[model samples]
Structure formats: structure tokens, C-alpha cells
Target chain A: MRAGAAGLAVWPRWRPVHDNGELKSGETTMAYSEKVVDHYNNPRNVGTLDKNSAEVGTGLVGAPECGDVMRLQIRVNAETQVIEEAKFKTFGCGSAIASSSLATEWIQGRTIDDALSIKNTDIVKELSLPPVKIHCSVLAEDAIRAAIGDWRKKNGAE
Target chain B: MAKRVESAVAAACPGCAAAQEGRALFCAQCGRIQPPPGCDYFTVFGLRPHLNLDAAALEREFHGLSRRLHPDRFIRAGAQEKEWSLADTALVNDAYRTLKDPLRRTEYVLKLSGTWGGPGKEKTPADLLEEVFELNMEVDEARAAKQAGKDERAQRTGLEAARARVAEMVEGLDRELRAQWPAWDAGAEDTRRSAERAMALLVERRRYLSNLVREVDEILGE
Candidate 1:
């Protein structure tokens, strides 16, 4: 077997992400907030939409160094263009999963324009992300843009 | 362990005249800690920076080096020698890990050559870019169907096909990498230049493979 593979399975390590991206440091290693853990544990709107419905947009982003990937999807109401639903699936550290999970929660009920106003720093602040984990927030913000951009292009609103 | 920026230092065995190599823990003549040495992972095993490594040989050498580097052997030594043993042991462990994995070895070699972990600048291939756009739509459709209590069999099939396509692409690239490995291991000057070009493919292959793994997970229900 590979060197770290055995250790990883026995001890919490990268990959095999638990629900809400459980912290792997230790039993008492709760570096994240309850809110972050809560969002991660029970990410709201964790589903997909009909992208062909002319009302859906999807964004996928990953950090190469950290091996983190996030896919955020949004469905806009045709009449109001407000995000009727937002969903996400993230494969990353706890902070990244939380950031995307929180992103999906916050985007619902907001118009696409309003969603655009969401910032990485806001996510960093909201999740209380450390400086090193700040990239996770950045990925969440970028996923929003990419999803929205895809929606706009398909809807001829670009 | 992390590499340092110190200039190369060579030390000699205090008990014997045998010249100590970089990071040699013991004298060839006397079983004493050799003089302090500095070397990176490649230097630790006296390996050249390349992807086509003999894993069995590397592992064998790693075990041999690890035994000597083990700090337990230094319990009776001076404080500085014990500390050096621990540090060198840590370094050897990290080196063994990095050198053992083909993908990681490629990345490390590129990094040592100042080529890897730069700004993310690769453009998505036009074909794959279009696929990503289409795949997103399919994913949303599958999700929407699943949510609305509608039949998502079609959408699920669509995602499966997309994943298969990406998998096939990655497999092809991996085959190319395997073909290039021996050419690189030859290590002639001309082959080295060609190997550099091959390293570009290795990097791109890793990026695509990483994305494919994530995409597969997303489609196959995480």
C-alpha cells in the first residue's frame, strides 16, 4: 500500500469528505464555527435543477494545490430573475464545503444581480475563515460568477 | 521535509577518513554520525530529477536510509547529533513519499526546475470547455428531475455518459504519459529536452484528471 493511504483511512485525512466537511485535526479541533459546521453538516438546497429549463446556471471551480472542487448551481425565476433555488456540492476541506454551502443558502431569494454582490471577503467573514483557508471563500465567490455567467449566456442576457 | 536555502555543506567522519556524502548519518568506517550535510529529496537518494523512477529500487534505498536516519539509534549520541538524526529522518520520510508517487514525482521535479505551481494559466481545450457547459446543464436537469419527483433516468444516463467520456480522455492521456516515461528515463541530453515537453502533458493530465475525479464524484452521487 502507499505510505499515507493507510494512515489516511485510519486517521482523518484528505478525501472521503464527511458530512459538513468534518474537521480532521483532532476530536477537539473545532477550528470552524458552529455556523460553518452547521452549514456544512446540513447544507441547504443540496440538489440540482434542470439546466435545460432556460432558467438554470451552474459553476464548477477547483483549487489545484489543495485539491478542492466546488459546483454551485442556481435556478432563476423567469419572471423575477430572483434565484428561486441554489444548490451546491463541494469536495474540499471543511472551509470550502462550508463556503459553498453557505453561498447556496445566501443566494436563494436573491436576484442574480444581488448574488453578484456577494463577495469572498463576506464569506470569509461570515464563516470566520482563517487566512490560509481564505481561498475556499474565493472559490465560492468564483463559482457564483461562473454559474451566473453561464445562465446569462444561455438566456441571451450576456 | 521542506527544503532550505543554505549553501551546500559537506562534512567528514570524525572517527575515520572516509569522505561523507550529503546528509550521511554514519561514517562508512566507524558507526558514528557523519558530519552535517544538506541535500534535498533528489540528493538524498542520489537521484536525478525525472519521472521514470524505479519504484522498487527507490523503496529499497528509502528503507536503508530510513534505518540509519531513525532517531532511536541516536539516543546515546550528543544532543546535536540526536536533533540532526530526527531532522534527517523527517526529511527522508518526506523524500520517500514524494519520490514514490509518479504524479507527485513529476510535480516535484517540475517544481525543482521552477516550472510547477505557478499562476494557473492553462486555457481549457475548446472541446472540453463546450463539454463542461453541456455537462452543467445535464447536472442541473438531473437535480431538478430528482427534486420534482420526475423521472431522472435520462438525465442520470446523460451524466454517466459524460463521465465515461472524460474518463476515456484521461485514460488516453495516461497512456501517453506511460509511453513517454521510458524515453525520459534514458536521460540523454536530447531526451531530456523532449522530457521537458512531455512534462507539460503531465501537468495538464493531472489537472484534467483532478477535474474528472471531482466530476465523477458529483455525477455518481458524491
Candidate 2:
């Protein structure tokens, strides 16, 4: 038995984003919310930050289920620990893109600790994400936590 | 053999009241197109639920079934016969396509055995996620460099190298997956369950890597 085999039941079946069309042909697909469409169309802070900079923290996360990849980065003020800037890039469905876009918008200007308080449920509520797409919000939350974790590790801050 | 909830042979032919071949698309006694069997895909091909399949033999069977079940063969017959022909042909096509591919075949069997879960449950290994994310970063950087027209040759090389690496990983994972087939095909219950979990993990990882390769191809304008 391999390590983590106990969690095997939860591992993804793995559907590529491109496969969504083929899946739709087989069965019905739910429509995206208007907010999801808007965010997907014009995502905010879609760019990269300087990873080498001491002030910046980069978090890269993926949804194993849909093969969606997201990278969230934060530039923080060392003394005050306030997030000065935030950016994100997500390669996923509309819900995922919207979740991360909303995440970046929420984290900017907040302290690192304050940003950490943001929850996946908060994202789902804000985006009106369906039950199935709730994982996308979870991915966004994980990305935020990962980014802050990275920043904390670099700054050696508690 | 996998459990059978319903059998094609159990149903008497509507035309001649003759016994049907469990997998046959047509009734042998009356030469009538049979209804699409309520059985699994493997049963549709006259095979047990097993992971290790004979690809060449499957292809031959599929061709034979497709030719006989063609709707054109029933044009002179009544509307019911024509409808049966189309439905049987569709079932055969779907069964053949699903069974011919190695990954799809394994997944089908796994599902039949109640080992494979449907979609929505997905949690990637943290280490693998880290590795995939790092590769994505490199790919993104390469694309940005190409867009800026800075060291286009270097970016092309980097992208090619990344694609090659992902492809190699997929092939390696596939080989490992195929190796597990026999254990599930004929082994005892313990071995079969172990093989199922292993194959599931391998298939999941392969899909993730394959998607990366596709993304790399898109980045390269392929």
C-alpha cells in the first residue's frame, strides 16, 4: 500500500478543461452565474509578481479534479504586514477564474493576517458558486493560504 | 465474470422466439436486430469484465458488428427494424470506442466492479501539486519571453523540453498502470482491490500530466 492510499477515495478522476465540451455533449452542463461570467471575461490582477523579491509571496495551487492551475502572489509591507498589492493567474473554468479574481481584489490592502481570515465559503457566497463549483472557491482559498504561508516563511514572521 | 443484472440471452426473440447470443447484435435464429442489451460494455462484446483485453480481436469484432448493424441493411424493412438497427449500431459503436482504449477500458471495468468512484472527489498530492505548479511557472515565463521577442530560441527550447518531460511522465505512468491490470484481472479479492487503487492513482496522475502537455502545445502554437 502506498502512502496516502487511505485517501484514495478522494483523489480526482481527472477531467481536462477541454474535455468539458465532450462531457457536455454526453450530459447537461450547468450555466455559469452572471458574476462568474463577468469575472471570467475581465479578470482582475491577471499577471505575475517578482518571486525573488523579499516583499512578495507566491502561491501556486491546482484542482486535481479539473486540472485547473492557479497562481496567487502577494506583495506585503514588511513592517506593517499589510498586503500592498495582489495578483493572480488561473487556468480553469469560469468559477475558478472568478474565485481567484475575487480573491486578489479582496486581499489587496489588507494585512497578511487579515487576508488569512478569508474563507472559501466567503468566496462561494460572494460569487454565488454552485455546489459543484464550490471546489473552485476552495482552491482559491488554498491559494491565498499558500501565498501567505510562503511569505511568512521568507520573512520568518510568526 | 462481473455480476450481470440482466442478460440478453434471457430474452426470447420477438420475431421467432429463439434464444439470443448474449453479446450478438442480431438474433441468430430469426436474423433480426436485437434490442440494445441492458448489460455492461464488456458483455456487449461477448467478454467478461477484465482489464487485460485483446485489442486486435476487439477491433475485429467491432468491425463485424458495425457492418451487420448498419441502418442501411434495414432500409427495406419496417420502421421498427430500422430503429433497432440504429440503436444497436450506436450501442456497438460506444462499446467499441470505450473498450478499445486502454485507460477507458480499465476505468469501465473498475466502475463495473464498484471500485471506481464517479467525478467530484479530487485531492491532489501536495508534492505533485508543487511540482506541477513549478512547471506551470516555467511555461508561463517561456511564453512571456516569446511574446516580448526576447530570446525566442531559448523560450522555444524551454517549452519543448517541458513538453518532452511531461510526455515521458505520462508514458511512464501508463506503463505502470498496464502492469497493474493482471492483478485486477485474475487475482484474489485483496489483490484486485489493491490493483484498483493503484490504477486509479496512476490514471489520475497521467490525466494531470497529459493536460500539461496539451497546455504546452497551446503555448507553442501547435
Candidate 3:
């Protein structure tokens, strides 16, 4: 169990296991990642960084014309390539916020390689997010990967 | 052709009681000129002229109405009705787009109220008025100086500076609006007064930016 995993305990009880081994309860259960939703419903690490010391990576993505803007930040250990912190600010709907939150939660403490491998589908499946809202999670996942990619590129960590 | 059938349906002109068939320009019974086969933006969305609207509510309504009235759902209708539906849906889309964006929202709100293109509808705000006047004067001076064959460098420099200032102001206003939005959406009852005040400022700032952009365009002969 992680710092935030306790919140998910509520889901397994209410969720009915199905033939596909997926959880189904209601529309609320259908559209959001439980972790993402929890973070959106209660966001963590919601702020900025000391760009000088933090080996920071920031990603600003999404189109407000399509009606969502998300900013993702990651702080990584320069030598170890471990993600030390993650934060986000999003101008979007619930699913977008949840996706960002879920991504941040998943990335903290993981090595850059591990973080990179965590797919958008993993986040979607973890939270059971619906198709329409999957893009939101994908965007967050992309932002994280982008920030890491940027960090690696800058530091010659290819 | 499908277009011909659509034109024939439109020839009936739904608003008028007249039954005009092929080759008729005016209604035989009412003599009203046949209107194009589409609804106007306002009537299509079923909204009256209004400025202060809940945007989220409006979006919900638009999506809900679209589910019922969009032409995609009307493909089975005969050519005429389908054409009319498509045209009407396009109008609805245009209306939603215009009303959704803050700058366009302000312009359309004024236009719908018959306040556009009139003298003394309300003077632009004092701060905006000063900027507008200053920018206009600078442009005029530049043009005059150019025509009189004075040093063009000074005028060119002045024009660039003026354009940069307007751009910076627009960017600053956008930042202010974005910064204020989350606080406004938090739904604190006590914050309502402050939110309304902020919204007023945002609206005014948007108007000022629009005017400034137009003035700059005029100066550049765009």
C-alpha cells in the first residue's frame, strides 16, 4: 500500500468483478481512474518547483479550444534517475484533473525507465476511465514521458 | 439533384404561409421573399439576447439540443428536411462558437441587443479610452510624418513599440483571467462578489484588447 492507495480501498468493496476481470459499478466508476479521481477530487503536490536545484521538467499541453490545458512537472535525482517529486496544474474537466493526478502519483520514486514504461492504458485501466476521457490520462502520461525525455535529452542520459 | 430538391423545399419558405413551388421567386399567397433554408444563430439555439449566462449550463444545453437536432440524426428525412436540418445545425454550431469565446461573446451580445454600430452605446472605459486614443494618435502621426517625408525611422520605432505594448497588455489580461478562474469556480459564497468584480474587469480588458488590435491593424493598413 502506498500513501494514496488507501483511498482505493473503497472501490474494491463497491466494485463487482466481471468476466474480463474489470470492475464495474456505475457511471462514476466507468469514467474515471479511481486514483486519478481521488487526486482530482483531492489533488496532491499541486504547485511549482525551484527550477534551479530541482532538475525540473515541465510540460504544458492540451488545447483550450478543445477545452483542456494541463501542466505537468517532475523533479528527478540527477545521478540516480529516480523521480523525486511530481506536480501538476490543469485547466480542464474532472477526468483531465484525475488523469494528471494519477500520473503524478504513479511516477514518484520510480526510475525514469520505469516511469516511461507506464502506459496511458495502465492509468486508464487502474482507474477504469472511459474512452472519451482516456485522452486526458494519455495526455498526462505523455506529459510525464515528455518531461523525462526532456530531462534525459538535456543530461545526455540517452 | 439533392440541391434542387432542397431548393424546392426552401421555395415553400417555412416562415411564410405561402406555398411556392418550382420556379417561383416570391410567395404567391403572401408575396414574402423566400428566406434561406436555415435558422439564425439565436433562434436555432432557442436563446434570447443575453450577456450574463452560465457558460457550463449553456454548453450542456447545446450538447443536449445537438443530440436531438443535429443533421447526423436526420439523415433518414427526405432531402428537403435533411438539408434544412443540416443548415440549421450549422447555424447552431456557429452560434455556440460565437457565444462560447469571451471576446466573440461580448461582440455578439452587443450585436444582438441592437447596440452595435450605434453612437453613444456607452463610451469605452476610461483606461481603455486613453490607450485607444493614444494608439490611434500615434498611428496618425506616423502616417502624417511618412507622407511629409520626415525621418521614417522614428515613426517605425514608435509603431513597433505601440504594437508590443498592446500585445503585452493582451497577454497580461489573459493571465489575469486564467489566474482568477479557479478561485471563481471554487464556489465560495463569499467569493461571489469578488468573482463578479473580476469577471467585469476581464470583460472590459477583453474589449480593450479587441479595440487595440483593430487600431494596430488599421495602422499597419491590414
Superposed Cα deviation of residue B35, candidate 2 (Å):
3.1
- Per lDDT, the best of the predicted structures is 2
**After aligning candidate 2 to the native by TM-score, how far in Å is the CA of B195 from where it should be?**
1.0
Query: Given candidate 1, what's the lDDT at residue B28?
Result: 59
Task: Write down the TM-score of model 1's second chain.
Answer: 0.73
Considering only N, C-alpha and C atoms within 3 Å, which residue pairs clash in candidate 3?
A33-A127, A34-A127
- The predicted structure with the larger TM-score, 2 or 3, is 2
Q: Write the per-residue lDDT of candidate 3 for residues A20-119, one digit (tens) a residue.
A: 1123346334444456556655666665565445388766554211224466788999888899999876545566666777788889999988998988
| Shift in Å, residue B181, candidate 3 | 29
TM-score of every candidate relative to the true structure: 0.63, 0.70, 0.39
TM-score of 3: 0.39
Candidate 2 segments exceeding 4 Å error? A1-41, A46-61, A71-87, A93-95, A106-158, B1-13, B16-24, B27-31, B113-117, B120-122
Scanning candidate 3 chain A in windows of ten residues, the lowest lDDT window is: A8-17
* Model 3, position A40: C-alpha lDDT score: 55
Q: Number of clashes in every candidate structure?
A: 2, 0, 2
For model 3, what is the error of residue B169's alpha carbon versus the real structure, in angstroms, after optimal superposition?
A: 5.5
Model 3 CAPRI rating: incorrect
* CAPRI-style grade of the A/B interface in model 1: incorrect
